[model samples]
Target: MAVDQLAPPPAVPGIPLLGNALPMMGDVQGFLVDTYRRMGPVFQVRALNQSFVIMAGESANRFLIEHGEAVFTSAESFGGLDQQFNMRVHVLRGRPHRHLRKQLAAGVSRDLLAARWDDVMAVTDRTLRSWEGDPALPVVDRFQRLAADQLSIAFTGASSAARFEQLRSAFELVLDATITGKWPRAVLRWPAHRRARAEILAFAREALEQRAQHPTGGPADLLDRALAATDENGQPYPPEVRAGMALQGYFAGINTVAYLYSFMLYALLRHPEVLDRVRAEVDAGGPLTFERLRDMPALHGLVLETLRVYPPAPGSARTVTKAFDFEGFRIEQGRRVIVAASVPHLLPEHFPEPERFDIDRDFAAARKASVYAPFSVGGHTCLGAGMTEVLAVATMATLVRRLTVELPRPERPLRITATPGPNPGKRFKVAVSSRQEQADYST
Candidate 1:
């Protein structure tokens, strides 16, 4: 194919210097979806003074993930997160990335997560009980904090009230700052960001020191696993690297899990029939045991559907390392190729009636077709996928068994934010009443 014949993807013209940065920052998902509709599967949009080849659907996902290392590089793509994540496992490439991924994978292994079931349940119960007195609560904020607390406990066994609060505060500041994508590396120089980073590093350092003092035979949590983690050369990463990786876990677990949980509830509340089915499954399944949670396929499907509709991280990107032909476009080296994760889910070809929130959607077929990976796909797939699902299942089961939540503004539409995830802004509030109270009131 001639180079001239294979032109750049269709692009939405931009302002003088700003390009499409402002519009994208305002509503990333909507902008991308609208562009996809007008320009087809492949298009281009300039954001933040840089041009990105925006690719939609399953082929884009496969290209970005399966051939990620060969044709693209995560280190270049996620370099912006370097200061926040300290170029941890997620951002690294090649052997170091693989080694770190292997180590982190073992930490959140099925066996390990299964062992931490009691702790997860305890945290969930405590969090739900904490919301008892409140009439209306900001579900996102509360769930974010709850997720952070559970992650702190599950990852580091950090139980001290003061420590947990400090961790939560630091994570909140850091997450809020980074999630908006408004704060670049320059923002790190600000005192607030500096303080948050310092506090996180201090916490991680303390945890590392404590672990060093009291090493165990088996890994108790992610911290311990990272501490004992060795690279391909049989060399353990330095304390700072380990700590940075653990903080990365905290960052991902807290935000992604919380958003997914909140969206799951939002989806169920909108679909009462689905909510009833999930509740019945939970009620009949008895206690929310790990095994039972797995058996409840309705709940599982609900989570998957929620993920498809409101993906926590809606888009991811890769920087082309070597020139290659993708979907007829000659993608040159050094360009960024962006993949809108939720686009495949919304495609009519892949999903019939894509707008409908169907819990019984054929997720198996979707997965087989490479159309439904909310946690991402291929080599850099989320390490916390299993743990995240377990947390969501436990949280839903606990809430459904205990309370009936009502959205104050059920008719209101969810507004998307600039955050990487599908944050429905601050308008998502819910009123909670005990199941007994709700039943009595109905009677």
Candidate 2:
């Protein structure tokens, strides 16, 4: 129903200027969940000088998925996100946005992964193999690097793996700041972050130069796709321009895949019975392929369950360009709208025994019902989402098949740190053993 009245949505009472920024920053997901529950689906939350109209639950998800493009654009909502870098697809709208997204789409697509399957497994096998050497493992660090290496393999080719390994900290810092916004923008001024900025630009330049040096018709990665760009003038843009534009492709996740992997491991280690079931499922599957991996019910279920319990970046924010009305409340133009997608994940109506982490639950059906959007919805749905699904299932299966991992304190509940998004905290370290060593102990 359209409302001509200028009455805003119910306000979430907060302090005058700073508003709810402190609590919002402290636990963004928790704040969102609580506010949604308390204030109902549509409410206004102010943070600092900003006031955001938060739309929660399945209704919000559908609204964004269906009508988001017409009413919202991310440019202002995510202003200054580009920072030192020039343009990013996340902030663009209309033709320019679609153009860049199309270019980025193919490189990160599932098809490219299938085409480069050998390198994908090699990187996976090598990374997991490295984990066995670490007696006291920080799965977060290892998974963070693994994600970067995987992106390198997917984009710049496997030869850049060593280069990526050397630049791991740079990627971590850059992605942590850029993709996740976990660190305040001030953190970018640090000496180390400056070095990180240099390293990323250097990495981009080196990848471009190497491509030129040996122009083999290899499977086009994201970098290749980015370099393929031509301006509206129909002339190729300058190297520096393309490199800046292509920087987003190098993302390895601060809170995205990095934390997702950590949480998956945390969940599995927490539930030994589920871990054993997954291990058995992995064992029964002779050779793991995407299709074969999906056939492994327990493994698939574990992956899905992990996502439900610990979504890395659960909410997507957009700025309203044109005013719109929803549920009798009029959200004005220039308002910031946060689609609180995580709310439905824990809603008892959708998820029975909402707090329990059970593999038997059907989150896919929940997702089908528009209540679970782990990768989010609308024009800006995550590009790497499909790749993440395959990586999650494949990496978890591979980890269980080749190695055994144990938490230091298995009985202790997980403590989360929002490095801008939900992540398993520092205490979630693990002890690793090769499967052969484990078997020897059994023998």
Candidate 3:
């Protein structure tokens, strides 16, 4: 039977050739969520002369991401990646992807990251100083800048303090170019875009080469580790591959950590009471010490809750490698499937009163009823989850330890950006004051 015949009909009709592309192009994330409600979890959309099957809901997401066909590959999604990231190695599939992943694991082991805790603390302290006495500072921007600096120190040992603006602008430009639906070939060939690409690549290559020559032992950052890594064949990558890894490492850290920080800050800003309670808990729990940071059950609960609500990578799209049976449906080879992350976060069975941002909600008690995956699941799950937690604890603990952010106008709702963010829109004008003054601003 034909794949189309076997599968359910598309959730919505398209404009013949255009399919559902134009509406989606306007707002990608919103489009996906809204369509899913109308069409159900699995639906079809066509764009750029290709048919894409968007799948969501917990069961569908698990089935698609966990099950793969020989022909299904990440290659398609990553093809344009080279233009933006200068990455030559394909994360698509097969030996090459596994080799690179394993080598990276060896390079940025948990122990290595743990050793750099002092550096992270130093950067966090410096960032806190930036907000020391500001009467109306935006904590969101501060968090973004802080995370950037921390990532700089953790990844390249570069002091991102001075270069945060430049690094952020360059990254934003790259993300702005890539995250939207596919760009035309003409745009890729444009001299301006080409030049931007070349400049970023050149900068990354220079940094990696410099790091390779002077290795930082002990708590070496990711760059130094990548430079020191070797494949099973005992072969180290050339300058370009090492450079690409370094660039990828930085890219991965910048927005992701920033977004997580933003989400945490947003939660605090939105729920001043929760923020106050958290501050007290942190204080009472102990001096916001690194070792004790994770023990703060409230903060941990908040982190998990924020992640559930605002997953950085909400859904992932991949091409099918082989024909597979999914939920009694025949998913043919080479077709595309999307696994939505947001659906499970909102699923009634998984989260009671899903919209409410209650931190103390028992996630453990709702295990089978919940299939919430913030970092995703399976072998491709995010490698930086552990490091992300450490960084989050350091950041949040630092803020709570030193000062409380006083939102100038706590009544307004903050604006959000169109895409997943390390930096989001709608700044909150806040003041950093001693804990005693927090009561004055609370009401």
Candidate that would win on TM-score: 1
**Candidate 2 ranges beyond 4 A from true positions:** 1-4, 13-27, 46-51, 77-83, 133-135, 159-195, 231-241, 252-254, 437-443
- The global Cα lDDT (0 to 1) of model 2 is 0.73
Error of 2 at 365 (Å): 3.8
Instruction: Tell me the tens digit of each residue's lDDT in model 2 across 369-391.
Output: 87877778777877787788877
Q: Give all candidates' CA lDDT scores.
A: 0.73, 0.73, 0.65
Where model 1 places Cα greater than 4 Å from the true spot, the runs are 2-5, 13-23, 85-87, 159-180, 216-219, 437-443
Candidate 1 differs from the real structure by a C-alpha RMSD in angstroms, to one decimal, of 3.4
What is the lDDT, from 0 to 100, of the residue 120 in candidate 1? 66
What clash count does candidate 3 reach?
8
Estimate, for each residue in 69-101, the C-alpha lDDT of model 1 and write its tens digit: 888776665554555546377577788788888
Instruction: Single out the weakest 10-residue window by summed lDDT for candidate 1.
Output: 434-443
TM-score of each: 0.90, 0.87, 0.83
List RMSD in Å for every model shown.
3.4, 3.7, 4.3
Q: Write the per-residue lDDT of candidate 3 for residues 1-443, one digit (tens) a residue.
A: 55545764354677877777676554354566677778677777787566777777766655644564344565565455654665545443656666777766655455665666677777676667667778877655666677777766666777555656655655555554444344444565667666666776777777777776766555666677667766546787776677677776655566777778777877887888778777777666544445666578778877878887777666665777776655445666777766665567766667888878988887775444336666655445667777787778667766776776766777866555544342345465677765553332110
